[model samples]
Target: MRILLVGDEASLPAELSDYIGDLGEEWQVQTVPDGNAAISAVATSSIDAVIVAPVLPDLTAATLLGQMRTLRPETIRIALIDANASHRPPSARIIGMAHRFLPLPLAPEVLLEALTSLEELRELLDSPRLRSSIGRIEKLPSPPHLYLSLMHALEEDDDSSTEDIAKLVAADPAIAAKVLQLSNSAFFNNGRAISDLRGAVTRLGLATLRDLVLASEVFSAQSLSTTERNALQARALTASRLAAKMLPESSAQLGATAALLADIGLLLPGVRNEHDPAEEGDDRPGHAEAGAYLLGLWGLPMPIIEAVAFHLQPQRSNIRSFWVTGAVHVATALASGLPVDEQYLARVGVAAKLDGWRNSANDLITLPADA
Candidate 1:
């Protein structure tokens, strides 16, 4: 694997190069001292991944990463920032550009693990046919207009009210319907149906409602057979609910959101519909990566993006502990007809917890009868 290190740090390049060299001769590490050189390298080289410092000589890390995104959309991007940098949150532009953030006073093992994880994920999705198919997807539908309006309002003023957000959502009938449906779904378990947009908005809160808007917009963008759309939506809701039950409270919301959008790759242009047996023999890109690529472009949270990307093969993830990817993986398997990956579960040391999760998932009403 060819990894690029972009920064002007005098000592970092040597230290990182030495550590990466220990991984084996198959790993090639290149160091560039500034953003211009980094961009030139990416444009000229087949770099697999990049680790960039927060500050670069010619440009900020965000600008460098943004250029990288345009030049090499497939290359994995990691932000290597100072540990103290976490005191202030990253700008939205930076967050949108990088796939992962590492607090650096650097740990060799952690960096190695991140690289290894990216390598593993790449291996899982190495099919040339899949790459060709995904490459053909020129554009994805943007988030709903109402969602954009709500975001703009919130950004223009820190204290946008729920009423204002709800009013915006209500202006779009399709979005309002989706918000109401989700609010009343088993995932919420509110005991009574939510018929009003304002009530649904309050029930879901701004963060979750925002995620739902993105998901709903993506799903609605394409024209699908009613059966296929319904099936996909039901499975997503089931997986999301199960994910909420499996992950920690802090991460559960993001996990659910990830699960909700896990199969979005299926909607990308040129992908065959798995629901149609006639399309079984057709070559299509893996839905996980396609979905992640779209979400990454849209600047969703990295956890949600990674979870969607790796849900199909959680064992490839570098994170050893339970995470959104694991929950979504198991939930997706249970929601679909696929068998849960026993070996992956064992490797992650979560095999013991599966049966209980399976039982709970089975009882969820969102699951289809066949599932």
Candidate 2:
């Protein structure tokens, strides 16, 4: 199998590459820093499968996967995401239908299963029903052209002007309206409404706006159900608030992005779907693993990817970076609602000191919420 792995996480690439190498001559692999580069590589090369982390240094996994489907529809995609936190309904809807999602803590068995699943997807690729499914999936829940433009504007060099970003937001009335609506939601709750894109941009800041653009594209009316929609809104709002309070010293801008999309794994119909009676083993395998597989397909960053993969299995505990997924775990659980198990909290405490998986678990438990 020829695989293209796009992510900058120092640890995951090494581990994944080594694992593929151990699979012997049948498996070949290549690595890239972000989604855009991954797209270029795919255009010029032959890739059998693609694995991506959601929160990349330069681009998001969902954006990249959307692009890849346009360039090469045949390649199987697998997302690597953190599962400890919850995600919004729209993003979760996007992820649920992905070819595969692998979670963090890198269980060799699950990783192998994900790889094998790609082989299954490839076999089914030519089927008429499968082809139709892929077609619908390829259509994208959001308007892709507009989304890519907004992403480019927000992630431009720090010296880039906010005016350029404001112009991008202005270009899309629907997107602009969504942003303003979100800004005025009880979550943002600025005492007064400004009624303009510029005001929304200024108050939310570029990073928050960037995150919202991606979110709004997904959350369009087609994406939500009563329960799934409410869960996403609750998780996004709560996680963002808690992450801000917890990671005050950290400069990484994905605090809100991480929180808002944290529980995306749950929204996937595959993971949440009712179990088949014949399949006796755990129906979803693991929510985090399912999410990671989907995120990997989208080509997100390793940090966000890992957080999606390992949100539930804190005990699995082998993450490569603390900045992204670990922080996500701490902030996500606080936002989602605490575990019913006291022992779970104590276990989290022990892991906090031993594994250093973001000490915020302690504070998350203590404060619950900040004034």
Candidate 3:
């Protein structure tokens, strides 16, 4: 695995470098003391993952992630918080670029686990099933210009004025309309009404607005049977709501966007029948590969694209990626009415693995829509 560690502190960088070196000869780790150097490294090389610190001399991790949006465009970006940072992982911060949040006083074991798990996931993804699924899948939809523009704007420094953001939102009527609809969706549950695009943007904020815009952008690109489409939508809404709850303070908008797009591979264009008895156990293909391929094409952040691409293979994914993938796994399973009892969940990893997910299983299972 190739990793880029960006921070100003000499000690933190040294600590991280030592831990990564323990992973051995195959691991290639690079350290950039500041965001500019990090951005330059990303622009010049291929990096699998990036670990960024929030407070750095030259720039904050947030600033680096924004620049990275334009630089690598596809790398998974994670925030490394000082175990002691005063502010929590604010929702807006997570929305912008953070895929994973690691508190400082870092443990070598946990760090190694994230790296090892990442490698294993990459290997698992190279399987025959994924290859076959990718071959069978159709095209993926691109985010509309409005959606892309907002993402780019959000990645900007404060110099990116609000008027610029408002203009971007105002340009696409269809995207704007969907943004308003989603803003008013039960997810937001605004007691008061949101009447227009500007109102939606105001009520939702740029972070939330950006997320919904991307969601609507991808929703327009899929083709699915009514039943399958409805199921996908239900799972997405349920996942989005759960994501809001689980990651109550984290951004990962792309993660939420992945939640909406995760099951789309199940909507493969040429598959005539999903329930045909003969098709069962055929194992000719699966959803992960198709979804991953589609997301990769859409320029989604890698963690989200990978999670959507590999949610089913729990044992194959690394711990950090597992957090997101596991959440999606349980959310989708609950939304689909799969059993979430201890025994069933044990077989599923999530039922036994994630405390938050385990505790919420019954409530999630019994939700009016999912039930």
TM-score, per-candidate, Cα-based:
0.58, 0.54, 0.53
For residues 213-284, write the lDDT of model 2, one tens digit per residue. 665554443446755554565556556555555454453555555555566544444444221233566433
Cα error, residue 337 of model 2, in Å, equals: 1.6
lDDT for each of the candidates?
A: 0.74, 0.58, 0.59
RMSD of each: 8.7, 12.6, 11.7
**Residue 312, model 2, lDDT:** 51
Evaluated against the true structure, the overall lDDT of model 3 is: 0.59
lDDT of 1 by residue, 1-371 (tens): 99999876542558778889877889999998989999999999888788898877789998888787788776767887677764344566676577666777767887877776666545545654554444344444443445555676787988988787888787777878878877876767469877788788889887668766755665675566767776887788778878888988899878888898899878777765443454555556556777776565444666777888788778777677778888989998888867787888888788999989889887987633222
What's the candidate order when arranged by decreasing lDDT? 1, 3, 2
Higher-ranked by TM-score: 1 or 3? 1
Tens digits of per-residue lDDT for model 3, 1-371: 78988875543658778778877888888888888888889888988778887677888677777677556544556677665552333345443455455667667776776666555545646554443343333232333445665765666655666556666776777766666666676756459877766667777677666555655555554464545544555566666556545443564554466666667665555432322344544655455656665455334566676667655554444544335665565565555555333443465444445566545644642212211
Greater-TM-score candidate between 1 and 2: 1
lDDT, candidate 1, at 172: 70
In TM-score terms, candidate 2 sits at: 0.54
**Shift of residue 73 alpha carbon in model 1, Å:** 10
Clashes of each: 0, 50, 5
